[model samples]
Target: MIGKHLFSVEAKHEFVRLPHFGPFLTATAAGQAVDSLLARFDGLSIRMHVLASNQPDGVEAKEQECAYQLECACSEKSPLSVVEPLARAGDLPCAEEALRIANDHGVKACEIGYLKVDEGFLLLHVHMVTADLQKAMTATRWRRRELLGRPEKGEVVIMTTPIPMLANS
Candidate 1:
């Protein structure tokens, strides 16, 4: 099984100018990128979510988008993260998808927050709670069998990633 460690994430902006479309595109994209990265974590589930004030105009569309991203993240089997270059490839749909899923699960409920930005980077946040840390470690191992009905043996990797968005910026 993967190692056991408290995982938490809070993003930071690097201050790079985003495309002319707007900060929504930039911020949302970064959030999605975080969801993708989180998906890599073994058995790492989205415990909660929070909608940004700048989110989409329509509520229905936004819910669909959030659900999708969280689904992707739920499917992961490894701890996820983005290096300097990879972080820039954030996706908007991913954020929307994750949001929906988090909302549906009602596990990691929503809360007000902000992303930390510096230079050109942005941070999205997730607060995960585990009753049993060992259980969480074991959970990652069963993912393959639970979802795919397949079994394998290997060391489950532990994870520690900052939130999708930053906080206290």
Candidate 2:
């Protein structure tokens, strides 16, 4: 069993409320926000969530405040691996393959980023919710049975965040 201490890197980002249309973060501003965050926390695995608002129906709220929350963490001793970036247009196959490889190796978590430079956003896909390190360790152990020759296939939980492409990139 992997030690829980191996995944103890907790540096989370505060929620950033920006104008958004519907529940999607497809706007250029959303992309910029994500890019800025990635730059601020270099080398750390960042997971972002689009927080839902509780506004009343038909309120006609202009400049609706949409909170983009980010959860970031990383550790040198962690076993989690980030798959290579793939094109956004056709990344399903690549993501599936990555998940398969992770399951085969008994990896409890996986990260896959889709580069959509033309669309101005980088789609980040993670196999777990919240960057909680302890949960990862527990899940890993539960999946890796001692009596069983091989670990059971871990759940493929996908959490995605769209990061904006840098101006130079």
Give the alpha-carbon lDDT of every model. Answer: 0.33, 0.35
lDDT of 1 by residue, 7-95 (tens): 22233222111111112233454456456545443333332223344334564454445444334333433233321111221333244
Candidate 2 residue lDDT tens string, 14-81:
22112222232233444545555455434434444444444434322322323323322122232332
Candidate 1 lDDT score at position 106: 41
Considering every candidate listed, which one attains the maximal lDDT? 2
What's the TM for model 1?
0.22
lDDT of 1 at 110: 38
RMSD in Å for all candidates:
19.2, 17.0
lDDT: worst 10-residue window of model 1: 14-23
